[model samples]
Structures are given as structure tokens and as C-alpha cells.
Target: MYMILKSMKKNKLRNLVIVVQLIFGIVILSNSLANYKYYISTREKAENASSSNVYEVSVENKADIFKVGEARDHQYISGEENQISTVYKIAKESKLVEKIGFEGLGCNSCQYTNEEENEGKFILKSKIKTIGIVEYSKELTEMYNFKMKSGMNFSQYYKSEKAEDVIPMLISPQLSKDNPIGSIVKLPGGGKKYKVIGVLDNSCPLLNELYNMGCLYKPNNGYFCVIGSLLTNKKTHLYIKLKDGVSKAEGKNDFDKKLGEKFETQFFGLDDMAETVTLPAPYAARYILFGIIILVLSSFGIINTVLSTILKRKKEFGTRIAVGATKAQIEKLVIGEFIIFFAFSAFIGLIIAKLISGQQAVWDFSVIGISIGIVFLILVISMIPAYFRMRKMNPVDLVHGR
Candidate 1:
């Protein structure tokens, strides 16, 4: 046993390869485990934004449902929607609905009106070219907890005719990082300036973040306003938080279709996977596959190395048998040496895996343990081949190198 240690020390390259292979295997397994945890967490978090027996929908109706909150009289196109509005107004007056809210949607595209300022600078997004309708929903804001990081939320003054209705804005994390917040962004049409308000939850749409970050850009007019027109605001989406006992998942197809017809548009069920994490899943899967492949390759290398060591020391094994070593003793010596090698390899691999994982989203100790366990299994399996090769050796002939 001491001779094995001395031999390993003498053959530094061989030992180094074994250690390296172990480390690689552990790192891959740890990363795979980390990724699995991230996806699971995401699923859980997305589920929380809904109530029990509730579902989420993203509506895109060309008809105007969201009304712009301006410091003046509200106006609507005298169309069939007005008829529905009268009915909804009556329904609300009768307390038939538990709650109601409206959010105005708007976007603006800006061209190189200020090319000198932006020509060389790397803008996170195109300059705003179009601006869409702005709406206010007290209930929507309260429940979503979408507070402005800077400036003020819509107050009573915004509802007054004398008050100059100002457009409150917010942005995404990406845009804010690219362009500092609290800066004024130029609009395409009127060259109106909208100040950065706050960055919303990271889960918020990047487009919304862009607006808050002042990185919003349009190629055409600086401002565009449209409310209750789902077809017009294609870029914007809606979120509905159901009250207790709401059943959008059940026999509400007729109701949903009616709403769809009233809005003159299609509604889509928005799944959580569609909303969060810009990181592509293919990359995660590729990492897992790569780790698995590396682990497999390392297992092959380790098994080969162990078997070669046992085979090379055949003469010593034969001598031990001739000196009254029982078959059990021989097997113990063989198995013990390999078990130690594998255990040592596993220890080193775990350390490497931990360092690489850091404090980010994924790989951990469990991954290392599983990986090492697999290595142990491979080691045992490989012993069978080595056993057959060396089992029939006659001590005398083995010692004489015949």
C-alpha cells in the first residue's frame, strides 16, 4: 500500500490526470444540478402571481378598453364599443362586478433627430419612434406594487383639467444598466421629454424597463396614444389577477369568447415560461449534456487507469498469493486500493465544483456526491474486466514474468 503511494508520487503525470478527470466530472454534475434548481424556482415564483384556481391571460384587442387619463374630458369613438361601455357602466352601477381597472398602452419610435448625441453612443434600444396611450388603474398599480422609483404616481392632480397631465414612466433592468435612470429621453413626434421614473421587477417586460430606463426609442412620431384598441397596441400585453374563486380555467370559454368578440381580437393564455429569463434553454441543456458527456469520459479514463495499475502490479499480487495470502485477502487489497482512489478523487472534485458554483443560481454538493457515486459504480464495473484478465495467473509463472 505504501509502495502504491510512492509509485503514484513518482508518476506525477498519471496522478495529475486522475485528479483532473475527477475535478472535471464534479464540476459538470454540480452545474447540471444548479440549472435544475433554477428552472424549478422559476416555475414556483411564476405560480405565485396567481390565486388558487386562477389563470392568466394576455389580451390583444383592437377595440379600445383602456381609457387614457388626461387632465380634460374623456372622449371615445362613437362606435359599437360605446354600446358595450353603457352596459358595463350599468353593470358596475349595479355592483355586479367585484372590481375593475384599466391600463393605457402607448409606444413611440424616434429616428436620428439627435443623431449627433446618439450616433457614436451604444444605445440599448432604438430611439423611441412611437408613443402609445397612457392609462391609470389604481387597483392594478396597488396589487402589482408597481411604484415609481423616481417622480410621482398618478394623483388627484392628474385627474384635474387644470393640472398638466404628465406621463409617468418606468424602465427595465437591462435598459437602466445600459442607460442611467432619471435622464430625459426625447420623443419622436413632439420632441416631448419623458423622464425615467423607476425600474420595475426584473420579471417585468424588457420593453417596460426600456420606458423606465429612458432607453425607449421610436423611428417615427415621438408620441402615439391609443386606448381600448388592442389591435393598435400590439407590442403591449395585459395581466389579470383573479379575485378569490375566479375560474378562468373552467367553463368560461363562452365568456372568454364573448370578451374576445367585444374587443374584436384574440386572447392568449400567457404561461410563465414565456415571460421570464432571456437565457435560452438550449444553452442550459447543452451545458447538462456536456457535463454528462465529460463525466462519462472521465469515468472511462479513471476505470482504465485503475485497471492498468492493478494489472501492472501483477508480479506483486502473485508473490502475495504464494506467501499464503487468501483469495479474500487479494480481493480486499484490490478493492480497497481502488475505493481509496475513487474516494480521494471525489473529494478533490467536490472542492472544484464548489469554487466554480460560487453564489450564483446553480451546482452544489449533492451534484458532486451523485457524480462520485457514479464513478464508484464505474470503478466496480471495470474491476470485472481486470479480474478476468488477471484471475487465472499462476503465482510461479506470474512472478517469473511468463
Candidate 2:
């Protein structure tokens, strides 16, 4: 302990460099851990949203698809509506298909507008961010496989023959508690109003991310309204949940073969447009690679410092050897000095990291434990030169300064 303090006091600059290296290593590691936690949480939510065996199909009117400038200018027949009807008929007849639904074009970043009355004057307040708006069929619940938290799904009204008098909506549980069942939600720009009929489970981060972030709603869980002309609109997307043992490729092949026979000129397929649901960010590899690089550099710095210290204290080590100290005792003394330095540096690093990142930084204990392990690994690396120096220490070398 006395030798450790003496060494520290004599090699202040070298010790300071080691301390700075430790601080940098810990701060980098803690930041990476915080990012890793965020990435994992988002990935888990995305995974939960996609556990169902659902497939997507995109279709557009053959005429509208070919000539795309202004949709309003095209005076074409409703090819999309006909295709949707045919697809629905084919799906219902197939034993391999379970449920099917249609979703209109939606945006993840849009604004929600509403009116607020301030002293007899109506003021407009816009919620600048939303998950966009989409028209979802009753069968969407089956396709999404979301557990209903409140009210009911639109399954009973899935049939085209049974026209709905009022639009019904199924929302996330975060949105449902405030709106409740039977409450009316008005759309922006004075459009159609929807009745909140159901609340979905905590899953489905697609919609829930915006809701949880305070972007979707002003006073409640946000609002959903039926829009677009359903099957007639080319912007609509088909979501189909296949029966057990059915792969997406198989489903796509069947749809292509069947639809090819009907629409000779137009192309309608699922595999070309759809992607499997998973968080696209490969944060695990990115953070791990960076961490390894930084730690390697830090370890080298520590090793250099340790070697320098040993080189400067060669006479001191020789004197100890002459005084009948064992090589093992000298080694312990050298290793013990580093152990204390590292332990104290780690403590200071953690405290500074917490203060800087604030509450947003998630400190995973597993990550912290791994960091400590790495510190010890660095200690072992730094001790390699000391181990060899102590082993070679003798009375002649101590006196002659070899």
C-alpha cells in the first residue's frame, strides 16, 4: 500500500493519463449501453408487433398505375375495386387463408389538427406528429393478431354485404382509456368522425410508438377515423393472415398464379413489395465493434503506463529483491498497485457518467459487470512486464542496474 501511494505520487502525469483513459473508456461504454438498451427495447416492441403470420399485398389500378400524374385526371374504371373483390373471393375459398383486411395509405409523421375554444373564440391547435391515418377493415384485428383490451373488433362487419352506418375504430390501449368505448373522434380538416369501439393490447409499436411519445394525441390516446374509398382506391394495401404451415413465399406464388390468370396485363404480387417486420437498426454489432476498439486502445495505454513505471523503478525492485523479498511478493505488490488504481478509476468514471447522461441513460448491470471484467483484463495485460521484471530480479542486476 505504501509503495502504491509512493508510485502514484512520483508518477503523477502517467497516473493522470491512466485516469483519463479510464474516464474515456467508462463514458463511452455507458453511452453505448444506454443506446443499446434503447435499441433492444424498440426491437422487442417491433418483434412483438410482428409475431403473427401476416403478409402484405399491394395493388393499384392497371390504368392508374401505368399513367401516374394526377389521379383525378384519369377517367378510368375501378380496376382496384374489382381486383380486391376477386382477391377476397379467392381468399375465402382457399382453406389455407385465414383472414384478410385492407389498409389505406398512412404516414408515420403527420399533423393532427383540432379546435380549442378560448373565451368564446375558437383557436386551432395542431398536434405536429402522428402515425398517419389509415382505413382498416374489421378483419385487420385477425391480420394484426392484437388482443382486444376493450369493446370489440369489426369482425362481425367484415362482409361487404353488411354496410356500416357509422365508422368504427380499433385503437391502442394507451389511446382507449381516455376516449373509451362509444366516444366520437373527429378527424382534422372537418372530415368523417369515427366511433372508438375497441382498444388493442400493449403490443403493436407501429401505432403505439407515436402514441406513447405524446405526438399522436392532444387530450387523449389519439383518434382514428375511416378514410379513403376502401377497395376502389389504389392506395389501399392488403394484409392477409395465412393458415398454419403456410409460408409467405408459398402464399405469394399462389396469389401471383391466380391473379395472373385474371389480370393478364397488370402485375399484382406480395413478395415484390412486402418486407418482414423487424427493427432495421443492427445496433448490436455497431456498438459491440466500437466498444471493442475503444477498450483495446485503452488497454494498450494502460500497458504502456505499467511498462514505463516498471522501467523507472528497476533499482527499487532490485533493492527489494536484495532485502529477501520473494518474486511472488514483488509481483503482488506491483499487481496490487494497478488493482487499486483501476478500482478507484472505475468508481470515478461511473459517477461522472451518471451525472452527465442523466436519467435517460439506462445503466444495464450486465454491461457494467462486463466493463469491470474488462478492467481486470486490462490489469492482467498491464502486469505482464512487471511479472517478467520481478522474475528476473537478482542482487547483481539490482547493484549493476541492468
Candidate 3:
């Protein structure tokens, strides 16, 4: 052990270079691991957040216009009757449709404020559903867990003894001013003042990212998968939560079989949410790109010191061989030194990788494993040839300073 330590100390630059390489590899691995973990976790949370026993019916009709553009061109089909109410009635009759409720579309009057306006108001303009407070449990809030900064989900909005008098409402925190919810929102038709019962959320950065996403995109977690739902003309983009261990495909299948022509609904999963989940090919490209950057920086010090050590030790090596040291033995000495140094360096590098990955929360265990594996692999490849040369030297000529 003492001899090994001394040998490493004598070659400070070489040891340091190898250590830096290990550190780089570990950092990459840790970050990757954490990122993957976040993705898997968030996706599962999204899937399981709701009861598996529950699903929704999106009425794709003029009365059920979910998108603003659809409503813009739509002329009401049935007169003197509530079209949405009628659709809800048919949907409720479907075998697959279980425990259905309706949330009436809000008027723009209730969506706009004295301070600012909400983009979600577009849906409100299209006509919306009104829900009973108790019925809201599975209706409005059972999707992704948006970190709540204030106010409960609109779960209890319509459930009450004062259902008539309780005009309570929930809006995104931004919709609130220094205190926007308590104030009445101006109605689009004018003269109607809707009471703002509460503000939504203003917590994690993850939530902010989700809020910015296009209607099609839902953040997988608080960090990336944010937009849990979207609305389209004649279609209600329902946010669904499957039971734990249920596949989105399976859930969609169940929905179709059960609903059966009552409504034309499209079921989308994580991949469908975006442009199909990305290829690891791109992930590999990222790894290669970032790895190249890290490796180049690491190689400079490593290459410089290794070459310097080889040059400086030429004489020592020549003498060792001339004194009848076997070629294999001489080679082993050179290779062995590097092997030990690299192992230590790789360990330290791994620690650094983990520390740096703290913020990312990506899982990178494989990266770390590969990195450590590569460190020794590179050492063996790099040092083996050098060892041969040192071993093949003509000691007598070398000693005479050839």
C-alpha cells in the first residue's frame, strides 16, 4: 500500500488527470439517473392520481364545444333545450360512463379581472361545465398534483347547503392580483360580477413550466409534464388518471368498448401527449455531445501528464530492463501504476458526479457504472503499448545514453 501511494504521489499530474475523468463520468451518470427517475415517477403519479374505476365522457357536439374555434362556427342544433345537459344525459346512460357530472362553461365575465386576464379564459368563452362541489373530487382535480400555494382544488365548488348563494370560484394565482380572487371578475356580457373565492397555485418551478406548455403538452411531473389537458371544438379534453399499474392503452380500450358509439372520443397517453416519447437516440446524442465536451477537457491534463511521465521515466525503465528485469515485469510496472491511479481517480470522479447531479434529480447509475468501467478500460488500452516499448528497450545502449 505504501509503495502504491508513493508511486502515485510521484506522478501527481497523471493521478490528478485520471481522477478528474472519473469525476466527469460520475456526474453525467448521476444526472441521467435522476432525470429518468423524475420522468418515470411523474408519469406514474399522473397515471395513478385518479381512481382506476373512474373515466369521463367528452360530448363532441355544438352544445359540448370544448374548443373556442369550434364554437365560433357552430350554430346551436337543438332549440329551447340545454344541449350540454342533453349530451350529459346520453353520456350518463352509456355503460362505460360511470358517475358523470357537468361543469357549465364560465362566462368571460368571471374569467377576466381588473388587473389581468387568463389564457384559460378561451375555454370559458367556448362554454364550460358547472360541477357540484362534492362531484368535483374526480371531475376537476384528480389529475397531476399541482403544488398548491393557496386554496383547495375546486372540488367543493358546487357541493353545498348554500349551493345557490355560494358563487365561489378558483383561478390561477396569476389571475389574482396582490389579492385578485377576493375581488369580482368582470363578465364578458357586462354587469355580472363573479366572486373570486380563491387563488390556485404559485409554488414549484415545475408548475410554472407546466402552465406555459401548449394545450397538447402535459408535464410528466411538476418539472416537465404540466399541461394535463386540452379542449377542442365539439370535444372535451378530459384529464384522466388510471388506477395504479394500468396502461393508458388498456384504459383507452376499456373506455371505447364501454362507451360504444355514444361518443367519439380519442384517448391519448404520455407518448401521444408529445410527439411520441422521444428516441433514446437523441438522448444518446446528448450523451455523446456532453461527454465529448467533458472528455476533451479531461484528456488535456491526462494526456499531458501521461506523456510527461513516460518521457521522464524512459531512463528508469531502460535500467530496469537492462538489469535482467523481464519484459513482462517491466511492462506490468508501467501498466500497474496507471491502473491504480485511474481506479482512485474514478472513485473521486463518481463522488463529484453525484454532488453535481443533486439539482437535476435524474437517475444516472448506468452512466456511473460505465464511466468507472471505461476508466480502467482506457488505462489498459493506453498503457499496454507503452509498457511494450519500455520493456523492449536495449538496456546497454540506453545506459550509454543512446
Candidate 4:
């Protein structure tokens, strides 16, 4: 160990180059693995959503008008009857429709202020930054597999009609830090109050789904409130699950025939919707390719450096061998020096990569295992040329400068 440290100090410039290469290689590889893992996770979630056999229906009122030159030309001219409500009713009555739900953009201008009881007076806390809101049905919650952090999901509130005075709402994990379960949050001047019946899990599928559909800018920073009743005045989208043995095409055709020319409707399956949302396969593949290329180049550079170092130290190694050191000892000494360099490089590289990726610095077992495997492989491959040279060493010839 002392000799290894001394040698490293002596070859400071060379060792520094190797360390830099190792660090760069490790960082690239680590981030690539992370990206691949994330892609797989996202695809799995999308597949799960697809397995639910849910489809989204976008509706457009035929009576609405649009002009080429006018700003905000798409004026929503209200018809005598609510076309969306009629579509919902028609879907509800259809034999092919198993479950149906509707959702719409909630009040974007609304603000949520938490009221805290101080002594005998009520004080308003700071207003929470509301990103956006979605007015959805309990059926949509079931369709998206939304889990709750605390309290009951929308199903309980929707069926039992609990907390009749205040509107039942579910806030995201980001909002739950300030507002706990059963907390009353009011929309200032909106003349409506909301009761936090549930706090959604951090990994809410509904939020992810909505984000895919461009409904929410940020998935974590949003709120979900149960729709009191479906109305055509509000622009809404429908989530419909067809009965078993019924294809999506069949369902779309049936709905189209029923609605006729009054409303424009487009249906999207979960799989198709997910394709637009999740990371593409090629994107993740590019990372993996770049990582592998870096790893190979780094390995080759290290091997060349190791071979050069061995060539230069032949006389020193020969002297040691003549005195007492065995071939195995010399090999162990060289490999040990690299092991130290690699271990240090890996530690720094992982920290740097985590910072760059904006992810937590927590090292999981899989990451640790991969790091170990990489170090081991690089160590073995880089030391091969040095090992062969050391084995063929002739102490007399080496010392005599042969």
C-alpha cells in the first residue's frame, strides 16, 4: 500500500489523467442507467393504464364558431340544450359502456387560503400557489388507479355524499405539506369552500395521465375536486370504459352514430395516449449507446496507460522480483493502485451525476452493484497487458538494461 501510494505520487500527471477518464466514464454510464430505468418505469405505468381499457373522448360543440382573422375567434355560442350532457346521458344509457366519467378544467383564477385558529379569532395563512385544478368524477379515479396518502379516495365521498356542506377535494402531495386531511380550504371570493377529504399519493396516475393530455402543466402542483354534476356549459372531456369483448373502434363507431352531426368527438385509448407522453425508446437507447462508447474508450485508454507504466517500471519490478517479491505480488501491487483510483473516481462521479440529474443522492443496491461490476471489469481488462509483461520479466536482463 505504501509503495502504491509512492508510485501514484511519482506518476502524478499520468495518474491524474486516468482518474479524470474514469470519472467521466462513470458519470456517463451512471446517468445512462438511470435514464434507462426511468424509461422502463414510465412504460410500465403506461401499460398498466392501458390494461384498464379506458378511453378518452374529446368533444367539440358544432354550434361554436371560429374565424381566421379574429383574436379568440372560437366563440362558444351556447346552444339551447347542453350537447355534452346529452352525450354523457347517451353513453350512460348505452349497453356497451361499462363505466363513464367526465373531467374539465377547474377555476384557474381561484386561490386557496388556509385558515388557522389563533386564540378565539380565525387567521388566514399564506395563500398556496395553485398550479391548476381538474374537476373529475369518482369513476375517473378508479380508471386511473389513483392512490391516496391519507383519508378515503373519491369513491367514498361520491357514493356516500359525506361532508355535504363543503365540496370534497383531493390535493396533491405537494399541497399536503400545508393542508392535512380534513382541512377546510376556501376559494377566496369564489363563494365555494372545499374539504380536503384525501391527500393523493406522490405517484398519482391521474396526475400523470392529465399531464400527458396537456391538462396540467406540472403534475405535482395541482388539485382534484369531484364534479358536483356534469354540465354542458363547462368544456369537459369524457373517460369511457367499454364492456368486455367490445373493441375501441366499435365503441367509437357506436358513439359517432348516436351523436350524429351535432357534436364532434374523438376517442383516444390509454395506450395511444401513453405513447405521446412517455419517453421514446430511441431516446433512452441513445444514452445507453453513448455510455457504452465512453466506457469502451476509457477502458482502452486505461489499458494503454497501464501498459506504458509497466514498460517504464520494468527495471524496478525486476529488482523487486530478484530480492523477494513474487510475480503475483507485483500484479497485486499494480491492480491495488488502480482499485484505489477507480473507487475514488466512482464515488466522485456518482455524486456529480446525481447533482447533474437533479435526483436524490441515495444509492440503491442496484446502483451500487453496477458500480462494483464496472470497476471490477475495468480493473481486470486494464491489468491484462501489465500482467503478461510482468510474468515474462527477466531480473538479470532487466537490471542490465537488456
Candidate 5:
């Protein structure tokens, strides 16, 4: 190792070129791995939610219907509840649909007016926006395949026909991990208290984001049901999961045709089919393609640098061989030097990659292991050419400057 370092130092220009090339290669490799990991995670999240089989129908409302002259009337709220029930009913009636769910105020989270007064009098508090309190049911949970982290699903016993005891609610995975099951979460302004009957181990980005943003899942029913909110103008999102062996083609042909006509007849405002609202995978093919290009270019650069360095040091190998150094020793020295270079370049590259990759940069053991594996791979690829070249070298020919 000492000799290898000494030799690298002796050949400043060549080592500099190799180091620079390696730095570039390692940077590219680290970034590519990070991107690859991100894409893999995104794919997992999408698949976990069964996105391919699930479709979303956006329930928009006609603005003109609620408008009174220049301003919209707060008392004129309508359409969402009926539209939601109708969609659920149709999906339930459809043989192609396996499960259905709905989200009132399609946004992942929203503000709620909550105020509880003392002395049997109501005191109003300033309205505040909260996260993740989506209006959904057990069907919606099934549609998204939300796994329970702790406790059980909403009990049939707890699904009261009317708002009586505290409504059973499911919290996000993050919330579940932080809070205990059966814990009561108070709504904003101490309005309603929901018992955390279930915890959702979901990676759905939007849901997670809402949870992170302080949204707790509460029953979108009782006194606070979205229908009665001042923000009743917000739309509901209907989600449906098709049964296995049922294709989107069937949905387009039969379901879309009927749904479009029904909405038009009812004048419910939306015109597009459910398929139009398919959640796009956050990372696309271009990210994978660019990662591939970076890896290919980096590998090529490493291979070129290794082969050049070996050829440039042929005379040194010849001198070593003449001095009674065995073939194995020569090979060992060359491989060792390259390994050291690979480690140094990879380490520096990783540091730089993390510094520049912003919030996405991660330095966990898995990432470190991957970085080492990538450097080892580059070393192995470069060694093939170096090994063969060294095998052909002879003391007499090399000393004669051949």
C-alpha cells in the first residue's frame, strides 16, 4: 500500500488524470444510485396502493349554479354529498369494480371550524387549516390497500349509524408510530374527539405529506361532515379499484361511457373519465434513462483511465520483473494501487454528491454499501484489461522499450 501510494505520487500528471476521472465517475455513480433508489421507492409506493387497478373520478361542481350575482352565497352549498353517494352506489353496483372509496374536498387536508364552549354555550374560534382529515370509509381503505400499523380496522360496532360515541378513526403510519392506539385526538378548537382505532401504514405520498403537515384522520361525519363546511365548494374524489382480470378498456368502454352521460344529464359539472385522474408516478423514465447514461459514461471513463495508466507504466513493470519481482507481485501492486485510487475517488465523490444533492441526499449504511459495491465493480471492469496487458509483458522486450 505504501509503495503504491509512493508510485502514485511519483506520477503526478497520470495520477491526477486518473483521480479526476475517478472523481467524476464516482460522483455520477453515487447520484445514479440515489436516483435509482428513489425511483424504486416511488414504484413501491405506487404498487403498494395498487395504482394500476385503482382509478380516481374527480367530482367537480358547476360554479355558475352556486353563484348569486357577483358573489357566491354561503347558504347555497350543494352537489358534493349527492354526487359522492351516487358514484359510490354506481361503483358498488358495477361487477367490474371490486372496491370503492371517496374523499370529500379532494385536497389531502383542509381547514375546519371548531369551537366548543363552556356553560352550555357555543363559542366560535378562528378557523384553522389542518392536514390529513380526509372523508373516507372502509371501502376507501381497501381500495388503497392501507395496511394497519397497530390496532384493528373500524369495528362494525364502532361504525354507528349516527354520531353518538366518539367516531373511530385511523391515523397515518407516522401518527400511529408516534401516538398510542386508542388515544383520543381532539379536533381543532376542541370540537370533536376521535378515538384512534387503527393506524394506517401507508406510503402514499399525499397522505404522508398531510400527516407530516399536522393532519389527523377524523370521521368526516357528524357535525363536522364536509357537506356542512363553509368550504363546501371543494370537490370530492371518488376512487374505484377494478377486480382482477378487468381491464381499463372495459372501464373506458362501459363505465366511462355511462358515467360521462350520467354526469351530463345530472349536470354534475365533470366531463372527463376516471382514468384521466390517474396519479402519475413522481419519477419517470427520463430519470432512469439519465442515470443509465451517467453510469455508462462513468464506466467508460474508468476503463479508459485504468488501461492508459497500465500501458504508461509498462517500463516500470519490466524493471520490476528484471529485479526478480514475480508476476503475482506485479499484478498485486497494480491492483492495489487501483483499489486505493478507487476508494479515494469514491469517498470524495460521495461527499460532493451528498453536499450537492440537497434534501434528497442520504448517507445510510445501504447507500454506503452501494457506493462501495459500485467502486468495486469499476475496479473489476478496469482490471480485466490491466490483467491481460500485464500477462503479456516480458522483461527483455519491456527493457528494450518495446
Candidate 6:
């Protein structure tokens, strides 16, 4: 190791160039891998949810029948409610519907506290705009394949105990990390405290989308919570999951006939509903392609530099061999130097990638493992030409400048 470092120091400019190329390659590769992993995971979850035959049912008031001027009138409100109820009734009566769920906005004035105590001392964690509180049914949990990382699901909470002042809630993984299960958080001004009964899995589609809500306009400042209550209000969106082997067209046809001509209903699959959340396939592919190109170019450059460096130092290796050093020892010294260079470069690259990607970066075991594997692969490939050249050199021939 000491000799390797001494040799590297003797050729500082050459080693510095290698390290810079490696750092550049690693930075781009890490960022690309992180994004690609995120995209694949998100797409997997969306595809899984879509395969469950779930569809979102959206009801809109007919623009022709409801004049724009009567939007706030009591009659308009009643008509809207009636239409939602009629659609709900149709969904309930349809045999194609295996289960139904409703999701709607929660209290706008609700403020969440990170405080653990129930003594009314509240430390505001987030406001209404940054935090999304969704009221949903227990069936929604089953309909969309919601998994719990810890604690109990909404059904378990529903069966346990009922508190008038405390509401049982399931929070997203991001929020759950800060406020784990059994954490008592109050929604001040509403006279209700939210009890964290469940922590949702990271793969939950709803939470995933909610977590990425600020990708367009904001800096990803969003948290999500779900309460086990079905809101039948006009603003509530309905979800229906079909039984196995049932086609969406069948459900749509039945719903269209039952909803009549007064109300308009539209259906959206999970992918369609989450189009804004997941990264596009083409973009992810392009990122990965660019990263691969950089990585390959950097690897080739390093290989050429290593081969050149080895050729220049043939007299040094020959002198070492004449002094009783074996070929294996020489090879080990060369490999060790590159390993150190790659390790330092990778560490620096990871930090830079994290800084650039910000909230979107993923640093899981898979990413780290793959990055390490790629670096080692590059190291081995870069040593190939040098290894062959060194093997063919004879101490006498090298000393004679042959």
C-alpha cells in the first residue's frame, strides 16, 4: 500500500486525471441509477394497482343544465349532492363492482402538531396547504393494495375503540418516520386530536403521488394522511374495484345506463390518474443511456491511461522483479492503487449526486450495491490490458529497453 501511494504521488498529474474522470462518471451514473430505480418502482406500483381492476369514477355536473350563475345557489348544491348519491347507488347496485371507496379533502383549517403530549401544547409541524388530509373509506385500503409498514390498518382501528375527540389516522411513510405509531397529534381549532394508528408502506400509490405533489411548482414540501371515513359529498371522488375477469367496458356500460343523461361519469385507470406523479419512460431511458455513455467513455479513458502508465514504468517493474518481487505482487500493487482511487471517487460522487437530485434521489441498498458492482467491473476491465502487457514482459528484455 505504501509503495502504491508513493508511485501514485510520483505521477500526480496522471493519477489526478484518472480520479477526475472517475468522479465525473460516478456522478452521472449514480444520478441516473437513482432516477431509474425510482421510476421502475413507481411504475411497478402503478401497474400493480391498475391490474387490480380498479378505476376512479368522476362525476361532473352537466354544464348545459347547471348555469354558471347558479353555482352557489342552494338548488345547485342539492342537485350536485343528488347526482353523487345517484351515482353511488348505481355503483352499489352493479354486480361488476366488487368493492367501492371514496376519497375527499379533509378540514382545510386543520393544523398538525408534532407534539407527543396530550396536554394541549401544540408545536405546528405543517399547515393545511403543505399537508394533505384525505378522508377515505376502509374499503379503499383493500381496493388499492395499501400495506402497513407498522401498526394496524384502518379496519383494525375501526374495530378497536372509538373516541369522540380523537380520530384514528393512517399516515404516509414520510410522516410516519417523524411521527410513529401511537403518536398523539392534535388538529388544533377543530377540537379533534389525530391518533396515528397506522403507518402506510412506501409503495402505497396514493402516498407516493402525494409525496411527489410539489414536483411541478414547489420544492416537494408535501405530507399525506388518510382518515377512515367515507365522504359522500359532491366533492368526493369514488373508486370501484371490479371482480376477477371483469372488463372495465362492462362496468362502464352499466354505469352509463344507470347514471341517466343528467349526470356525466368518467373513468380513469390508476396509470391515467397518476400520470403527473411517475417519471416518463422515455425520460428515464434517456437519462440511463446518457449515464451509460459517460461511464463507458470514462472506463475506456481510464484503461488507456493505465496501459500507458504501465508501459512507461516497465523498467520499474523489471527492476522490482530482478530484486525478487513476484509478478503477483506487482499486479496486487497496481490493482490496490486503482481500488483506492475508485473508492474516493465513488464517495465524492455519491455526495454530489445526492445534492443534485435533492428530494428525488433514492439511496437504497440496490442502488448502492449496483454502483459498487459497476465500479469493480470497471476496475477489472481497466486492468485487463495492463495485466496482459505486464505478463508478457521479461526482466532481461525490459532492462535492455526492448
lDDT of 1 at 100: 42
Sort by lDDT, best first: what order? 6, 4, 2, 5, 1, 3
The local lDDT score (0 to 100) that residue 168 gets in candidate 2 is: 64
Best by lDDT: 6
lDDT of each: 0.47, 0.55, 0.45, 0.63, 0.53, 0.68
lDDT score at residue 124, model 4, on the 0-100 scale: 16
Q: Report RMSD for candidate 6.
A: 5.7
Which 10-residue span in candidate 2 carries the lowest summed lDDT?
A: 116-125
RMSD, every candidate, angstroms: 10.9, 8.0, 10.9, 5.3, 8.5, 5.7
C-alpha lDDT of candidate 2 relative to the true structure: 0.55
Residue range 318-350, candidate 4, lDDT tens digits? 788778887688888888886788788888888
lDDT of 4: 0.63
Candidate that would win on TM-score = 4
List candidate 5 stretches off by more than 4 Å: 12-17, 26-55, 59-101, 106-131, 142-144, 155-164, 173-178, 202-235, 240-315, 318-324, 347-378, 397-402
Candidate achieving higher lDDT, 3 or 6: 6
Give, for candidate 6, the lowest lDDT window spanning 10 residues: 211-220
Models 1 onward score TM values of 0.50, 0.58, 0.46, 0.78, 0.61, 0.73
lDDT of 3 by residue, 83-132 (tens): 44444544455444434432222222223454334533322221222211
| TM-score for candidate 1, residues paired by index | 0.50
The per-residue C-alpha lDDT of model 3 at residue 201 equals 46
1-402 per-residue lDDT for model 1 (tens digits)? 764565457658876776677667656665656655555444444444322332223323354454433111243424334533533343244322344444444443334456534633432243353333343344334333333334333332134324232344455444555445545554343434444455545332222322222222321332322112221322233334444554444323423444444432222222433244323345656776676676567666756776777677777766777778765666666566556666787777666666676343445456556666666666677567656655665667755645
Per-residue lDDT of candidate 5, residues 1-402 (tens digit): 776878778778867776777676667656656654543553455445434466664333333243322222322223656555546666777888777655545243334343333312222111333344555654554444445556665443245435545656666554554446666555444455566666555433332232222221233211121111122334356667777898766754555454543232121111122111122222323443444355446556656766777778778877877788787887888788768877788789888877776343335677668777767775787678777877787767766556
**Model 3 regions more than 4 Å off:** 1-22, 37-266, 270-285, 292-308, 319-329, 359-367, 394-402
| Full ranking by TM-score | 4, 6, 5, 2, 1, 3
